[model samples]
Target: MPAASALVDLENLRHDVDDALDRHLTRLRDEVAATGPGTTALTDQVSTLLAGGKRLRAAFCYWSFRAHGGASSGAARDAVVRIGAALELFQAAALLHDDVMDASDTRRGRPTAHRVFEARHRERQWSGDADRFGTAAAILLGDLCLVACHREAGAALDALPTDVGRAARDMLDAMTSEVVVGQYLDVLVQAEAWGLDPTADEDRARLVLRAKSARYSVERPLTLGAVLAGASPDRVAAISAAGLPLGEAFQLRDDLLGVFGDPEVTGKPAGDDLREGKRTVLVARTLAAGDDDARLLVTKHLGDARLTDDDVAALRAAITGSGAVAGVEALIDELAAQGLSALATADLDAHGREVLTGLAHAAVDRAA
Candidate 1:
């Protein structure tokens, strides 16, 4: 391995992203604090949210940058690290708003930001509807994170050459827009009927996944890094080819985790996705099996706000018995293989390729 590979290693990437985020957020917190006492709440919550991620996005961006010959040290490397920080900030924004939309009570084993604010309101006997107050607060906080994301990104892009910087800036702007559209699509699907056509249901779910996560979480990060490195269209195209499938697999793993993941590990209630009535590809597969009973089970309990442990157990059994879990796992494996295959042929740094392979596996094979 070239010594430069060490700079993009997962551990090093995490440290770099975190360090950059800390510095940026600390300054932000101070700025908010300047407004008056307790004004730092938003920045505090952001800081806390930024602390827990695995930095997968950062890893993807950094490794692709090194692989496509961006830079390994000095100013260019710092710009890349700042870009990674911007990605993390955007992710934090997503988590905050997602919790509010899903009415999620916890995240990463802690009270979701809205819930935390809500509890404080109750404790203080505050006037106005505490629930509404909490929701609004979280939403504003999410908005702040969005602006902060743009700020970090703009600063970093300004440091690069105009052409490459413009390319990366465009990518970052599109990523935000795509994620917002995907979020609405997800909400719309949850509000409407599913399984009317299994194939359509799966396709719609995949569409939402691709826009909401696959591209933003995986493909764009890779492309952004490669673009910053001034990668030829051929190289950028190759990276995207690998990214899309791997990104699909990455989100598929998340779908599985949403239903089956342990709360201890995932920091959310078990079967929370079911409670939220997510029409994931897994749910589509169960219906696709043409099992009426499975369909009935999903229809009855999948989105029940008052679902109990027993109800969750029944739903799990129905899903597993219909072979949906296995089916999804099989798809994950196949998609991962396709991504790895595409990656195999890419002309890039040897060490970067090897690390990317490991990162891909690590992304798909995880407990939370």
Candidate 2:
């Protein structure tokens, strides 16, 4: 129907997913517009949320399909593209709800959806609390995106044989449910007290990080790709085994970026994790290793909303001075090595192994 690249190239895979997202959102826009023009903003906000993703999950799926010897241009490839777009939209839904939960101000260098909606409410002098309205609207937007994700995945699966499709859909459902549960785990960890036992804190943080990020971001996608490609249970397991470690390293990099990354590049403010008092592994390690003064700095400033530039600086100093940064970096390197070693164990073709090796580096070595 339209000119498109059907190759399995990574960059082209991103473009193909974007095209699918555009098609899905166009349908969403038309459907929403049918209700009324006022509802268009909901679709618009979802659109905004979908922009600027790294599409690492999509890449994993696409290449996993390729790695499993799935065809480059055919029904399977197209189905994987739809599934990739579904993953990206699902990620969008997660971000929408996550920002509201974290009370975040920015995403991908733009004001967050809730914040944007809140500003619109204030400007229009809406009656209710602007903050509450924003939260409600953003939540509903996330729900809509979640629905769209399922629909896309279902449609993509329809093209395959029934049994394979059913299993892939099961994987999709598991990924979705696991992420929600993991998010709740994250919330639970953040709300309760910590620092009593560094071991417990690190264990809890690892659980949250793996559930909320590692599995969803990498392992599930890779496993799902293998499933969609009609790989056997053992093959799927192998893919997940290889992907999980890389996923952990990826999230660890994200945790590092949260505290030390530039706002301009990361699209979130500096010291975001510190201000949020994430109780991350980094924080846990700092508490374990820091001198009393560094520990005091962490206790005083972590999660303080009124934190200033100087306060952020001091906190950063404390974290680095405590040696958590280097510790985390070393851990990241170790995990990356483990993932690559696992990948080597998989019976991948040469090209597949090469691509996956590249992706492992890209996932773990990124700045954003």
Candidate 3:
């Protein structure tokens, strides 16, 4: 499997993209500066979350726009870039809040923004409990990013024709709403231990994964760009046909990496999702395999952070023996193939087809 970020030119693009984001972050800092150092802390928190990522969503939006006949150097292109940047800002908001919701301490191999802020509260011996301080700071910072996302998006859309501007706004609204709904479903599913039947649970997990990650990450971004570029209804449907399966494959690959990837490469601890009791399709399938001892091992150690190396090894053995690993891998191949077939049917320019093809391969073959 290739790395999640392996396809792009990171060094060259990073400098330009970072410069754009830095200006945005500086603006955020200046706006918050009057609120005192604590607000500045929040600004830094947002910047940190925004600083690193594959920038896949942004690139997808930009390229899709261009491939759909958006202008290269005119207002259309600039609007597309700003729209992409807005997507990145929205991602920052999601990650900040997601870390809090998941109680995840790390993101991209660093302390999550909330944790970083909370630690500062502790070292400074602030007035409130550090945990509470951290949570509050993180939530506020997340909200800030959400607002910034809209503001940036508005500025971007201002350059477009009124119809395109309205369409862009609608896309942003729908994307936000869908992701939040999916997120709520995810939290509710995990909180209630809702999946007990192996097949049923696995199905639900797959749906949740699609709604929460795949659509927002790939499908919607591509469609949004296409819509802004004035896609016909048939054209929009064609793009979606290609994007949905590919997006599913993308998340399935991510699920695989979450369980089996090397920490050094993935920047996430091995079996972290298992420890988090993520209720992924993989776990559902393992449970459904109906191995009593395997089920027992999962029930006992699945979400226990105190689980040792031996415990994780045992859990891995149980999962593998359950035949879920092979099943999931097969599903990944099926979804990727479905996407490629859909792309073949879509009315696409050469460049659009190429980009989607590259994305499909990169997504499914990704190690992280």
Rank list by TM-score:
2, 1, 3
Number of clashing pairs per prediction, in order:
1, 0, 0
Local error of candidate 1 at 88, Å? 0.2
Better of 1 and 3 by lDDT: 1
TM-score of each: 0.96, 0.96, 0.94
lDDT agreement with native, every candidate: 0.87, 0.88, 0.79
Per-residue lDDT of 1-368 in model 1, one digit per residue for the tens?
A: 22333434544776778888988888898889998997787887887787778788888898888888766787778888899999989998988998999998888989999988898889999999999989999999999999999999999989888998998998999999999999999999887778788999999999999999999888988888899888999999999999999999999999999999999999888999989888899999999983788889897787787999888988999999999999999999999999999889997798778877777777777789
Per-residue lDDT over 1-368 for candidate 3, one digit per residue giving the tens place of the 0 to 100 score = 22435433322333445566777778878889976765787777777677677777776676566567766567777677777778888888888888888777778888987789889998988787899888888898889999998988898899889998998798789889888888898897887664367777877888888888888788888887787788787887877877788888888888888788888777777887777778888888888884899988887777787767778888899989999899999998998899889877777777656765776687678666
Candidate 3: stretches off by over 4 Å: 1-17
State in Å the error of residue 122, model 2: 0.9
Candidate 2 residue pairs that clash: none
lDDT (Cα, 0-100) at 137 in candidate 1: 91
**Tens digits of per-residue lDDT for model 2, 45-142:** 88777877777788888888888888889898999999999999899999999888888888999999899999999999989999999999999999
Instruction: Report each candidate's C-alpha RMSD, comma-separated, in the order given.
Output: 2.4, 3.3, 2.3
Query: Where does candidate 1 stray beyond 4 Å?
Result: 1-11
The count of residue-pair clashes in candidate 1 stands at 1
